[model samples]
Target: MGIMEILMIIIPTTLLWAAPLIFTALGGTFSERSGVVNIGLEGLMVIGAFTAIVFNLTFVDVFGAWTPWVSLLAAMAVGALFSLIHAVASITFRANQTVSGVAINLLAAGVALFLVKYIYGKGQTDIIQRGFSKIDIPILSDIPIIGPLFFSNTYYTSFVAIFFAVVAWYVIYKTKFGLRLRAVGEHPMAADTMGINVTKMRYYGVLISGALGGIGGGVYAQAISSDFGHATISGQGFMALAAMIFGKWHPLGAMGAAIFFGFAQSLSIIGSSLPFLENIPNVYLLIAPYVLTIIALTGFIGRADAPKASGVPYIKGSR
Candidate 1:
């Protein structure tokens, strides 16, 4: 394909792939911003994907065309509930945040697979009967290059992700709750002295993180994977984490970083078709996003600051 033709195909694919990352990374932003390090986003996403797929498969007839959307809600609820494990372990019990997160990831994987076997009598759930379809925006889709690149044949969740990122940014930076969340993250003792409830803010952050992460998984399953299995979620959760770090814990920044990763991911599939990349090794293209992630986290992009009290257990009266 010519450059313009290639561009047409690549942009939509990139955005489609980026949608999940954007949501999950935003979830990470919420958790980390509240001074809790949630490394279990992967597990949360796995549960979300599995729950969404199973719900959609089981209820497609009843929900008709809305099955996917409803399944997303189910996924979100499950994701939040599962995240409570991490919240309790890290916040209430004051366990090592990283260790707790790792446990969450392992637990999510084991439970999801076991449930798949128990419920489906197999290793994976049936493919969803219906999945999210692409649609063009009304007037904007009629625009020139921009329309074809962004508004045409795109998943609605892509726009929703961007909108939510903006909303998350507003909530984290502009609102009263956001102020308290930040205060707790930067200095829990100071926040406690100011009468803000440190544990409460942390819980709020973790719950929101779970909700968004679950939604991300649901969107990926409904729009991309179209099924639930051991491999359904793979490692997108970790990529989202990388995006969170790449973006310096800012929602908009995370979205941008996700888009970049999405672009790299898309290249793996489309590279074979593009004239310039046609000769490149598939291995290189497949690993590009991950390689970029490792590079981003290694300070090659300069040091990124995290919330000061992140991963630190807040003891109410301790100096």
Candidate 2:
């Protein structure tokens, strides 16, 4: 394929793949920034993917093209509802956040698989016909080189994600609430002395992570898999978490990192389709992303000093 043709497909596909990661990674940023370590993002994503597919299949004929939007709402709601378990365990009950998050992941996996088997009578849900469509900017799409690489054939959700990345950056850096959130993460006792409710902020952070993470998985199902299966969200949430760490927990940085991973994934998939690359083993490309995740995490561990109190439950008297 020519450069333009490859760009036309790869760019849009990368953006499509990146959307869910962007949202989920940003959600992780919120969670970790507020002293709650959420490893249950994987579970939240599966819940979202399943709920979105179910909503899409149930409402496709009635809602038509609006099914994707409705599914997004369903995903967010389900994600938040499910995350209540994690919230209660970590924030209220003072359980180990890592253990709690692991529990959530296992529970979500079992539940999602059971539903797929019992309700669908198979391993997967029916495919969705209604999904988000690409939007082409009239003037920008006509430009050469950068046009197809950036503007042309862009999904609406991609732009929405870009907007959210900017908004997230502003909200985290520019808002008073952000200050309180950081305070809660840094020193809960100090924040409490300052009249900030650390508990409430933690809850909000986890809940927001859940909701956004749900949207991330839902968007992925709509675009990439076009269906919900037990495997639909497998490893994706973890990948997003890796992206968050890879980006040093910054919103825009995480967005860029997630998009980079998306491009890597897209390139791998496309490589097998190309004439020359068809000879290479697909297994190598398939494992590249995870391998990169490991390298990033290990290499940056020293530099990525998470929030001071992350994963630590705050106690009134213990401190």
The lDDT of each candidate is: 0.92, 0.86
TM-score versus the correct structure, for each prediction: 0.97, 0.92
Q: Could you give candidate 2's per-residue lDDT for residues 1-319 as a string of tens digits? A: 7876766778888898889999899889989999999999999999988888888988888888788998999999899888889989999999999999999999998998898898889987887788777778788888887877898878878877878889988888899988888899889999999899899999988988999889998898887889887678878899899888888888998899899888777777787776667798877766766776677667654465678999899988686
lDDT of 2 at 78: 92
| Poorest stretch of ten by lDDT in candidate 1 | 285-294
Best by lDDT: 1
lDDT of 1: 0.92
Let me know the TM-score candidate 2 reaches against the reference structure: 0.92
* Candidate 1 TM-score versus the reference: 0.97
Off by over 4 Å in 2: 135-139, 274-285, 298-302
lDDT of 2 at 28: 92
